[model samples]
Target: MENQKLILVIGGTGAQGSSVVKALSESGRYSVRILIRDSSSIHATELAALPNVTLFQGSQDNQKDLHAAFTGVYGAYVNLNGFSIG
Candidate 1:
């Protein structure tokens, strides 16, 4: 990733965002950054192993977490769970 643009992915552990994250990683274009509640989870660890993928452990509701996740991102893909929010 010489001039890679970092894409921040929210809800990346869920059904939808996981695939997006993988595709982005496989594309070899942008660097993928995912925010997850459990950084040590199997899925999180798996994503971290992918090319250009970085895992950041944090919740969306926290401003500090959001700030850190959003830092220097080229763009974002957010798909928060409505049920979980309720």
Candidate 2:
């Protein structure tokens, strides 16, 4: 799968992130790595069950975790926690 594009998705267990993961995974064009805080959580477990979707245990608050998640990824989709009207 080296030829496939690697996309790192932060907050992939949340509602917004889960949608993005589903969409991208269905596209069959990219491999997705989801950054989740708890691998044993229900959402994380569900996402991990999907094909082409791997879970990376980490947190946005840690620079080291973020750095590790960003490695070798062709692209990234970061969804921070908050509500905003735009």
Q: Report the Cα lDDT for candidate 1.
A: 0.94
lDDT of 1 at 58: 91
lDDT of 1 by residue, 1-86 (tens): 86988999999988999999999999888999999999999999988999999999899999999999999999999999999987
Output the number of the TM-score-best candidate. Answer: 1
* lDDT (Cα, 0-100) at 46 in candidate 1: 89
Each model's RMSD to truth, in Å?
Answer: 0.8, 3.1
Candidate 2 regions exceeding 4 Å error are 83-86
Q: What are the per-residue Cα lDDT tens digits for candidate 2 across 33-78?
A: 9988889998988888887899999888789999999999999998
TM-score of 1: 0.95
